[model samples]
Target: MSDSLDSLLATADVADRRDEVVTGVREHAGRIARELALLQGGDYGSRDFDTDSGTWTVKYEGGALQYLRYDGGREEVYVVSAHSPPDPEALAEALRDYAAFVEAYNAYVESLEGVLDDVDTDFPAVASTESVAAERDRVLDRIRAVSGEMAGQLHRAEGTDYGTFSARVDGTRWELKRERDQVSYLRVGGEGGIYLLSQYGNPPATDVRELVGSVPAFVEAFNERVADLDAGLSRVEL
Candidate 1:
C-alpha cells in the first residue's frame, strides 16, 4: 500500500522546494496506515477545504492524498501528495510540518540573496601592474587544481568523461568546460568560475561565445581579488 502510493506521489509535480516536505508527509501517512490496518483495503475517501483543493482517496489496499491549486487554466501552481489517511490531529501536525518546511526554505533563499549582496559590495579592484599577470598565473593554477578535484568527484559520482574538463582564465573571467567532440552545454557559475559540461554533438561557435558572456559576476570578482593580492605582495619588502 505504501509503495503504491509512493509511486503515485512520485509522479505528482511537487515544486522543487516542497518536494522534501511532501515526501515527509507521505512517510508519516505510511506510518499511520500501518497502525490503522487501512492497508487491508476499502473505498473509504474524504475531501477537505483548506488553502487549496484537497482530496483523499483510500483504495482497499492503500490510499493517496493530493492537494491541487489551479489558477483557472491548465497550469497548477502547487500539487502535493501522500500515501495514507490522517486523523484530525495528524493532519494538523502534517500541516504544521509543511509550514515549517516552507519557512525554512524561504529563509534559505533569502540567505542566498544576502550572500550575493555581500559579494557585490566586496569585489576587489583590478590590479594595474605586472604583478597582475603573476597573480593571474597563480589564480589559474588554483583554478586548475580545484577543477581537477571537482572533475574527479563528478567522475566518481556519475562515472562520466569529466576528462575534457578545462579552464580558461581571462582577465576577470574564468571559464571552465567539460566538452567532448560535441555540443549541448550544462553550465553552472558561481563566485569562483563558470563551469560548462557539454555532451551534445558538434555545436556552433556561437554557443561557446554565448557561454563566455554568461560568466557570473562573482567569478569576475574572484579574479580581481587574485590580481589585487598579487599586487599587494609585490609591494611588500618580505
Candidate 2:
C-alpha cells in the first residue's frame, strides 16, 4: 500500500487509542466526583484541574490514574488525568486546563443549540425564496445567450482554414469554412441547434444564401423553443 494509506491506518489506530484513554479518564473522574461528594458533604460536579499547580496528582500503572480537588470559593470540583506517572506540578496544570476547556465547551454548545433552534423556526421560507430566485436568474441568463447564438448562426457560416470569428450571436458562434470550390459555414446554437452549410459551384455565395433562406423558419422555431424552456426554468423551485 501507499505511504498515505499506511499513514491513514496509523492515524485511525491512534484515534482509537486516544478515545479509549479519554473514556478511561472520564470514568476515573466520575469515580473521583462521587468520592469527593461523599467526603466533602455536597454534590460536586467534576471538572479537570491542573496538576502542576499543586492542586491534583495521579499514578497510572496499567490504564489511568485519576485525581480530584476542590475549589472552596467557587464550590467546584476538578478531576485530573494521568496516563502515566507524572510529577505533582504537571498533573495539576493538565487537570486545570481540562476543567477550563470543559466549561468553555459546554457554554459554546448551549449557545449553538439556541441559534440552531431559532434558524429552524424562522428561516426556511425566506431561504427557499432567495435560492429559487438566484437559480432562476442564472438559468435564464444562460438560456438567453444560447438562443441568441442560434439566431445569429442563421446569418453566418464556420470554418477553421478561413481564420476564426470572435463574435457571439445569442449564445452560438458563427464561422466560415472554405475548401477548393466549396465553402462551408457553421452556426452553433447552444446545446440544441447546430447547422452546417456547404455550397458548391462557382463563388458558392448563391448556395450559402439558399441554405440560410431554407432554414429561416427552422431557426425561428428553435429560438422560440429555447425561450419557452428558459421561462419554464425560471418557474422552477430551485
Candidate 1 per-residue C-alpha lDDT over 156-223 given as tens digits, one digit per residue, 9 for 90 to 100: 54466643332334433343444332222334443433334334332233434454343444345444
lDDT of 2: 0.43
Q: Each candidate's lDDT (Cα)? A: 0.41, 0.43
Off by over 4 Å in 2: 1-92, 110-163, 167-238
What count of clashes does model 1 give?
3
Top-TM-score candidate index: 2
Worst 10 residues of 1 by lDDT: 68-77
lDDT of 2 by residue, 82-193 (tens): 3433334433445455555445434544555555454555545434455555554454344334434653443333222233222344444444333422334344443333
Cα error, residue 159 of model 1, in Å, equals: 0.7
Residue pairs in clash, model 1:
41-60, 42-60, 183-200
